[model samples]
Target: MTDPLQDPRFLQDPYPAYARLRDAAPVQRVRTGSDGLHSYLVTGYAEARAAFTDPRLSKDTARFFAGRPSGRELHPAVSQTMLASDPPRHTRLRRLVTKAFTRGSVERLRPYIQEVTDGLLDGWAPGGEADLVEDLAAPLPVTVICQLLGVPEADRAAVRGWSDDLFASGEPARTDAASHALAGYLAWLVAAKRSTPDGSLLHDLVRARDGEDRLTEDELLSLAVLLLVAGHETTTHFIGNAALALLQDPGSLARLLDEPEAFAGALDELLRFDSPVGIATFRYSTEALTLGGTPIPAGVPVLISPGAANRDPVRFAGPDGLDLGRDAGAHLAFGHGIHRCLGAPLARAEGEIALRTLFTRFPRLRLAAPEQEPVRRRTRLMRGLRSLPVTW
Candidate 1:
């Protein structure tokens, strides 16, 4: 009976709801507010981990929705990506992407990430107020992703708007429109790269071929859209979420500020304390299976809550509290199994650079109005603040 999406408290701070779910019903069925879709919400750390790698649960939406009128059609842009496929297909797609998304590839972009971070911070005058989400968190990752994808600066705003709509809730028609628009745009972008390639990941993907295996036109478009949307959105929220966490706990913020070398470990704790992607993408049961002693019927949709699992007290001592020194290396913030985020390295680098640089530039940074609550994003797929107003 408890609907997390309908509850404002849950949207604002889901950790309490996650705690309740983990204790009472680790695997409980709930209907989504937007489309009334029924799904099993897994909250326990162990349960979520098992579900992530479980072969019984499937990511192939086409197979799961077969002969079912799911209202809207599954756009190739949505269905053809590695996020929506099973092994062999997912393996091939991931292989091609991994070649370009390697740690070294992302490491090469560190200077650019730092440059963008510094430029954004430079606009914020010391002892003046600024919206951290707008001036820093949002634009920093967007610029990095746009540059990496070879997206023109003039088109970044439009692309960001489309990306927002794709993850938004409540308006099914509007969401469809945005999805189509992004897919169409990526299709054109892929074609443009064919004639004159840019030395970007999109270009590398366009040219990627493995033993006579090449990405189809639709696959190329879907992959590009995925990279662009997923690559930026995760990091954008991460910076905001991490910054909010630090701002609220001056002790931890001070520790990181005093010990610059501690940012790496502190970043992991921040991710565990509040993940950007609250829930992993949808997965369906291929056959009846048991998760945390609860039986899931065949063909039922399952949603693994990384946000909840990361805060499981059984897995983490004093999980609700954020300890910068906590060993959070095993957190499921970037997900688990074969479908883990490909852009995690890039996101981690961006978070560290953005947080470190922002604090260094404004040592006395604090929330503009500590009494006022920050706005939370409405979508269940992501957990992030809309804006974080701050001043020094």
Candidate 2:
């Protein structure tokens, strides 16, 4: 059967489909595209967790397709980054970048995060409608990431345009164009950073590239693009999805508003309820492996759905319901194993500050168009509303 996942409705509310898939089997093969591309989908929590840490499931796409002839080649900017690499290369790149994304480093930005949140919300006058995605969710993370990377304010719009195009679905040509544009911009940015270091994370990366044999010129450029794009994209969706969830449930919203100090704990449950990243990035089998009693052949692609696994009936009681007090710290929203999201700490900090400040500033915040259905982004990789209209 053709994949039901390609349906836009599935993207908007995939929990039902995920429940069906999880109940049917722990792992099932499905055709992902009309191009005859197929992959194994791991839906159960135990199976999904194992798939994430399995050494046989490789992230090195190039190695996975070594002798095969494919119509498209992933841009060096994406292919060479730590996200798409294997160890010792992944080890080297991740080690250098981890220095800037530590819990302490991200925690230090809490004050700045609140300041940015306040500044954004201050622009939206009471009783006037504003798109939460545009005014708050989208710009907040981009501004923080740009500042952290030392990207100039004048250049942020262009950066955002390129990043959006890169993640946009069903636009191969646009995706390629954005990849090249982003790569070219990063190349220039790195060169400019080298001439005049600014103490930003990008500056430190440039130093690593030039001072030691640690990172190559290509790796440096790729890592910068990865940091800029991945740093904000997931967090942007996290804020939007979390807000939408609360808005849909007035009881939850009222409760959250009353307990302002509980935002941190509440954020984890929000992430688990509707994870920003629906599925983990592609992984291929290095050798034939059996998962949940099903044998997957080597060279076949495998996708682990955290969206599905988080709601597994066996894992959490009342998995579908939003429980702010639930211990959801183990959710695979940041993924697992060596390739886990490097910017997770930063994303969490941003989510907590953004949600708390937003609701606190506009306690009467409510959906501007309650009768209208939310328009979700069509991308297969992410699960988020394209826009969230709100007013106080």
Candidate 3:
């Protein structure tokens, strides 16, 4: 009975555990702390993919909690978003902003992204180390996304704070409070954009419509908040985790440095080797479904562990090793089926460019702190170092 939540082994390296689970049983009923809700954790590659695309699986927490007086309430704004909805509305909402993340759209922002990365690197004094998470990884996405959203540069810090408070916390109560604050902040931004829309993603979304269909006030705020949080936090981790991986494997770093173009392949490998969003956004069961030979009764909560599946030996040849040139496209790090991450292309571009800039500029970069002392978060949803102290 491995307690997945508090397992120290899982906290460090979960590959062995995932292999065991994948081999022993496609589905395992993990015991929960008495207080936590009972749920199914999908680990097998095939089963996980099936669970991801299953129509019987629901993302709307409201339907799962219907008539249940569990003192827990899903945030209305969050629950109403496309991420939490099924077809029709989901297709409509997703189509509204899909054009904003096309190849051309993301590529156009590369120069601006490079400038942001360089500005942050320039601020780091020679031989004077700082937390890479703070000085670079954390701020780069903030600047890039803020500019893309047409958010006033002055509001960047405030928006970042709101996003962090909203998503970084593990506790449900705290997350709810942060969600409230985030919703309010987004509402304010919508009003501000009303009077002064500019050439940015947010403004484009404001003007976006399908014939006569347009986003409602709540939909607008919800989508903006989703982009703000999703745009930065995931990219922050991608940059930090990929950099940390390269630092740990100097050979990989050197390879990437020599052939910057190798980033497309290497980035995929890094993502497959160690993903940031360990689990997909929470999925709830709509009907009694058999997953991995286990009966998942209707209304049970489900989480597909992409981190676990990415390292599953059944999926990767050398699952535990970091192969910079591996064909890592099959990994579910960006998820599978219809709900795959919409910002994935942008994230991949940002990661490739950011990693290239990092290694190329600071050729001698190494961890300032001892390897064992590196900071890591205890969060179950997103796996990342809290702070990565490094010096050139």
Candidate 4:
């Protein structure tokens, strides 16, 4: 069976294929890799929501990879973050990390976010062409995350480079190398924070507490790596994807530019219409179970498609169109369950500010190559554009 998820055409625009998959069943079994293994994708909104919290599907990476030799030795930072852990430990990590990574922390970043956006836009002149991905979309979040996390100015470019390589798909060697490099860098950052305490979020995280239960060395290191990698990569693409959608829809762009406040609600629709995280990270079934009424044997790998589920016609009216007016709050752009992205509020704040500000300033913004298809990156887990060249 062909893996629709990896097809180049499907990557360009996946909604049509997703609709067909949803029509076939709420859940679809498909070939996910070249290794001849099969995985279940919960594509319907309801099933996807359920699968997120299903106790039968364990997110523990050690449990999933036990005895499965792949010749890759992942760093603890790569293998043991909140994304890869389940319960009790997940609870503790989230609790401690949350103490430092608060919504208030995100709110404090708003002024700086605006400043960065303005600075990036300044690089391009009015009535000129620019790659939105490079000029505004990519740099905004990367700069903002480094600011929010208190990463030093000296290491910002290196940090961003490592994150880009870490998330670059289909390059296992580079990916593994990035994993160790980032993990090692973060380990040093953590140690530096301990000896010379600073006022940054990373320092706070190093000193984060939960009734005297501190994050162990591994937990702290992994969480830092997670925040650094997960923090900026998807978001760079998210701003790109959202900005591209608006460029293609002048009417929608006008609505946002005309009324800045409208973006607060419209961001959800944008997220659902073109999810940043196309598919939730993989998890393996802890035991045999029935999901969306489909039975699966114990230990089968599973994936949840936010891209497919968020656009199911039954759940969303005219799922293909971009409707900022629709109540899109129920969308699963951020996975539902305890493992939901911790950086979600921050991402929303950044997205709303990024999109609203970009169009508001560049009122005549448009695609540079309207006749050619947009180039999407080659990764199913995170759907984003490679570059969104535009002119105003």
Candidate 5:
């Protein structure tokens, strides 16, 4: 049991840990010393998928935290997201907003996504070479999400700042500050939508709230915040990771560039090769149970590693190899079963368009510093390059 977070081995390539854990102990108990945090790590694809769909494994931590010393309930604002609840609450809320996340709904915005992507590309100085991350990856998705959620285009910068803060799990003080800022901003937006409804996802959610009795006001606010933050953050990393994967593999990148119609298969491989959300959100135990021969006590927290599952040898042949033509629809990058990410289609479209357009625009693009491996974010929950410096 090493300090998984600080262990460089886990950082550089977690596949070894996943390989060992999957083979020897798919479910292993881990203790957090004095923090009083005890949990299980589910590493295998089948076991992880089962846990994902198990009604006994609750996504809502509120029940588990009851009478506990955790300060989670101290901030009612943060604990009120659909991701933190189970059915019928989770089912109801997800259904109410399903229209905004459908494949058809997201595809309708493809033309707009292209326009947004191309607009950002137009702004970049090709030969001068800019950080593909900042110049393109970050802005394109932010713009699309802002426009979709009805956030005023002028407020994109501020919204992005808040999102960065809320998802910053590394520093305690920073995470708290970001949480407050993001929550405050979302509260303001939710109130505005109530008074003046416009045609956007936020507006549709607000209207749905009036039309249905399933979601409460707080639940609606939390859902809105989740949609905005999760919507952009996950896709942001996907764009960066996917581009890095394709660039690192010349054969795959060249094929996609040579045949523009190959975006679909290439996108799947990119997702499987380097997932953006490296970890599943959180699920708690409902009752004591033995999983993969490891005993998990009731009410304990568990973190499922999706990135590891994507590379599971049992599930993928040459799991580490980049095969653009392989069938990758079974990849767990989007989690399996009912709780799968609602924004999958939107993310796929954005990733495909951004990656294709990026390479097409600058075929000679190369890392600004070839000697250094790109630094990744410290959070175990998400995988993203801290900064990607590039030149044409």
Candidate 6:
């Protein structure tokens, strides 16, 4: 079967196609790349949840490419991160930074996040139109993450540019250039943090490294790159996708306007309705195994679609429709098991603050062109609006 992932129409609204795929079978093989390679796409809610924990499915990028040379160099910046590893390595690397991202840590930033949201909104001209993505969604998370990561004010813009370029799908050369640029910049930042240690998170890691040598130089730099990029990108798009959905939904918009904090309570449903990351990151079958009753061969890539599975009819009644009051905790917007997103609490806090503040301030906020489909970024694994023009 053909993958509709890159098609313009599918990017606009992929649920309909996703529904058809899930209906056919929870697991189906489809050509997922321009090279005509096939990967098993998991769309069933139960199957996806199970696949996340299945030991037979491995997320080890370095191991997968070890003997088979892809005829290209693997950027250590991209390859050495915990995100692409398995077992003891993934666990060890994750433990290093997990303390800083706990719920308590993220909640402490609510006030600062609110202040940032207000500052961004303060710039919007009253009653005039603006792209929410550029003005609000993108900047809010970027600013907060940069602050926590100790990225200097002057360097943040460059850092964010590199992060954005890292996700520019369909452009391999651009992606490679960005990976190298960000890796180099982060190496400098890490060294600087070591020389003049402060209360920042990076300094803490540097201190940890000095004491026990828990991680290597490559791991340190790779970890920083992963955290910096993953920190903002998801929250940025989460806010964007959620805000755009609410603008298109009058009833939801009015409800949020009346009691903005309700947006926080509705986050699970909001994430379910339109996930920011369309699919979970890389995974491949380590041994031939059955997922959702279909056999997947060893070495074949396996993709789990949170976007599709969140709307599986068996898992959620009327899943396509957005129901703020619905119980959506089971949704897989954040992947299940060990590989679940580390920054989830941070993302939720940012999303809630950003959405609540946006609608509360502009009660009459609306899509500038309700008739036109919003322009969407075409990255293979991410789902987000390129711009969301809105007016009050």
TM-score of each: 0.98, 0.97, 0.94, 0.97, 0.95, 0.97
Q: What would the per-residue lDDT of candidate 4 be over residues 261-299, giving only the tens digit for each residue? A: 888889889998899988889888999998888888888
Ranking of all candidate structures by their lDDT, best first: 1, 2, 6, 4, 3, 5
Every model's Cα RMSD, please?
1.2, 1.5, 1.8, 1.3, 1.9, 1.5
- Among all windows of 10 consecutive residues in model 2, the one with the lowest summed lDDT is 206-215
Clashing pairs in 5: none
Candidate 3: count of backbone clashes, pairs at least 3 residues apart or interchain: 0
lDDT of 3 by residue, 1-392 (tens): 44666676675666677677778876766654446556688888888888889999988765666788866444677656778878877888889878555778988888988888888888988877888899988999888888888888887897788677655544677667777877877788778777787777887888889889999888888798788888888888888888888898989888888887777778889998889987678788878989888888887788888988888777788778899878888888888888898888878878887888877888899998654756666666677777998987
Reference-based TM-score, model 4: 0.97
lDDT of each: 0.89, 0.87, 0.80, 0.85, 0.80, 0.87
Off by over 4 Å in 3: 32-36, 168-170
**What lDDT tens digits, residue by residue, belong to model 2 across residues 240-344?**
999989888889888888889888888889999999999888899989999988889988999999989999989888999998879998898889888889898
TM-score of candidate 6 to 2 decimals: 0.97
Best by lDDT: 1
Per-residue CA lDDT of model 1 for 123-199, tens digit only, reads 98867999999999999999999999999899999999998888777676778888888888888888888888888
Worst 10 residues of 3 by lDDT: 30-39
- The reply for model 6, stretches above 4 Å from the true place, is 71-74, 209-213
Q: Kindly list the per-residue Cα lDDT of model 6 for residues 32-79, writing each as its tens digit.
A: 877798999999999999999998889988787788766444378875
